[model samples]
Target: MRQIWHVGKTVLGMLLRHPITGTSIIPLLPDGRIVLVRRRDNGLWALPGGMVDWGEDIPTTVLRELKEETGLELVQLGRLVGVYSAAERDPRVHSICVVVEAQVQGKMQVVDTLEIIEVKDFLPSELPLEELSHDHGQQLKDYLNGMTTLA
Candidate 1:
C-alpha cells in the first residue's frame, strides 16, 4: 500500500538525516590521575564522555559531559590525544571519536545522578578498569604512557 511505503520512506529518511553524535572529556586530576566513573549499566570504569547534542561543538560537549559526570570543571583542554572504535569495543553503531588532553580546574566530586554508581581517581596502573571494553582500556593505557613520556 502507498501508506506503508510512505511510512517506510519516512523512517529511512530520518535514519539518513540524523546520525548519532557523541563527545568525551578526558579530565585529569592535578596529580596526573584521571577522572573515571563506574557505570551502573555494566559496572565498567571508563572516561568521562558521552553523546553530543544537536548544534553542540565537540569540545563543548566534552566539557559539559565532564562536569555532569564528575562535577569537575575543565580549565583547559589540549591537543587531540587519540580516537577509538572497534566492533567489540562498542556494542552499537560505529563511532568517530576525538580525545584531547584536559586539565581540571577544581576538585572532582562524583555525581550519582549521571548514572555513575561510583567515582574514584587512580593511577593508570591502579585503574579499576576490569569491565572496560578491550579497545577503551588499551586507549587509556596509551594515554597513560603518553603522559609519562611527557614527564
Candidate 2:
C-alpha cells in the first residue's frame, strides 16, 4: 500500500511539473474563412483545440479537437503556424500549444456545449482580433503573416 501511494504521488508530481501538450487548429474553410469557437468559460472567441490525449499524435489531436469543438472535418492539415509555450499563455494551466492551420469543411455547430457556446467562421479581415481568448490572437497573427514560428 505504501509503495502504491508513493507511485501515485510521483505520477501526480510529474504531471504537475510538466507543461501539458495541446494543439490549436486554425480551421480554414473552402471559401477562405477561418473558424472560431465561442468559449463558454469566458464568453470569448478562441481557436478550436484541446490537449493531446495519451497515445495520440499531434495530427490526431488536431482532428479530434477540431471536430469536438467546431464539428468540422479536416480536409488537409496545413502548415505549422507556431508552437506557443509561454508560461502565462493560458490562464488555467501551463500548456504548450502546437498551432496548426487546417483546411476544413463542415457545418458549424457546438459539439461540446460545456466548453463552447457557438462556432462561427470569419473572413481574415473580420476576425474578432482583439477579443480572442488566450494566446490565440498572436497565433492568428502569425498565421496571417505567412510565417511559421516556434515561439
Q: Cα RMSDs of all predictions?
A: 6.6, 5.6
Error of 2 at 67 (Å): 0.8
Cα error, candidate 1, residue 105 (Å): 3.1
Q: Estimate, for each residue in 1-151, the C-alpha lDDT of model 2 and write its tens digit.
A: 7678668756865778988899999999999999999999899999999999999999999989999999999999988988999878987667899999999998899999899999999999999888999999999999999988887
Which regions of candidate 2 deviate over 4 angstroms?
1-15
Rate residue 78 of model 1 by lDDT: 68
Model 1 lDDT, full chain set: 0.67
- Provide the TM-score for each candidate, comma-separated: 0.75, 0.90
Model 1: C-alpha RMSD to truth? 6.6
